[model samples]
Target: MPARRKDPAIPAGLKIMAPEPAVRLAKEAEIGGLGLDWSEQPEMLDDVGLAEWERLAGVFAHDATRFREGERAAITAYCSWWSAFATAAADVRDRGPVVEGRSDMDRGRLVKNPATVAMREASQQLRYWARELGLTTDARVRIGLADQGDDKNDDDNPFA
Candidate 1:
């Protein structure tokens, strides 16, 4: 059996009040409330938080008419939740290596998926924000994408 999912460490409140699931929780926490006291609970938000959901709703609101056209992916709304569990590290500089590693991992797994690229982009933006805010060090930003299992090579593809 798969390992039990870990419970989100975020506190009971401070989450967005919306029920929508598309908003990226980390983005919300980072940019939603200014100077929000998130020193506790690992400083991460859940994908289900109301505030994040509202943001997701707003993104869709840009083209509300497209829903009937089947323009959105079933998982698009939930993908942003992946970042909600991100911890507000005690020191941004200290976590730089980890963030870099996570970025590379996300990029490696982002093959053939536009959403993955968006997520990777969002992660990079967040890192820059952290640096600009003086919340962490900039030294750990990774410059190269690591080869993930999906790397396509002429030798492996029968069609190639």
Candidate 2:
């Protein structure tokens, strides 16, 4: 039996989703600009597609805002890029269960693979962009995760 081939179109990062508002607003913006009904666009952003969408959303937000448009635009762009990259990484991580289930399957079983490697690469690229935006030497290094490590910072959590 031949090993089952994974679908090329179904990359590990495909499951990644952007922020909620991003998904809604970006699609609205895109469709409105195109003068097309939102539901009519079957190709309208799924979660993964929203990653790219948010980047443009950030651009729009920055441009429309009254403050330091240039600085805000750059900052928002960097954040959007990071979020997209992170979501992509998370998608790869989500594949773990599928891949594990294939362990005892026959050679012909289609194995779900992770795009962690690819996600990491994209993250690296985003990291560089973040650094450039922040004017930091180690944008990728010494990074922080979403979860706050200590209780003192627990207030930052929305649920708190």
Off by over 4 Å in 2: 1-68, 97-114, 135-160
RMSD of each: 23.5, 23.8
lDDT of each: 0.39, 0.50
Candidate 2 structure quality by residue, lDDT tens digits, 1-160: 9999879888766676766976765675554332222122223345554554454455444334212223443444455555566676676676652344445554655455555555666677676765654334353234532222333765678987
lDDT of 2 at 33: 39
Per-residue lDDT of 91-131 in model 1, one digit per residue for the tens? Answer: 23343323323355675432343344444665676555434
Candidate 1 positional error at 130, Å: 1.2
TM-score of each predicted structure versus truth: 0.22, 0.32
Instruction: Report residue 125 deviation for candidate 1 (angstroms).
Output: 1.4
lDDT score for candidate 2 against the true structure: 0.50
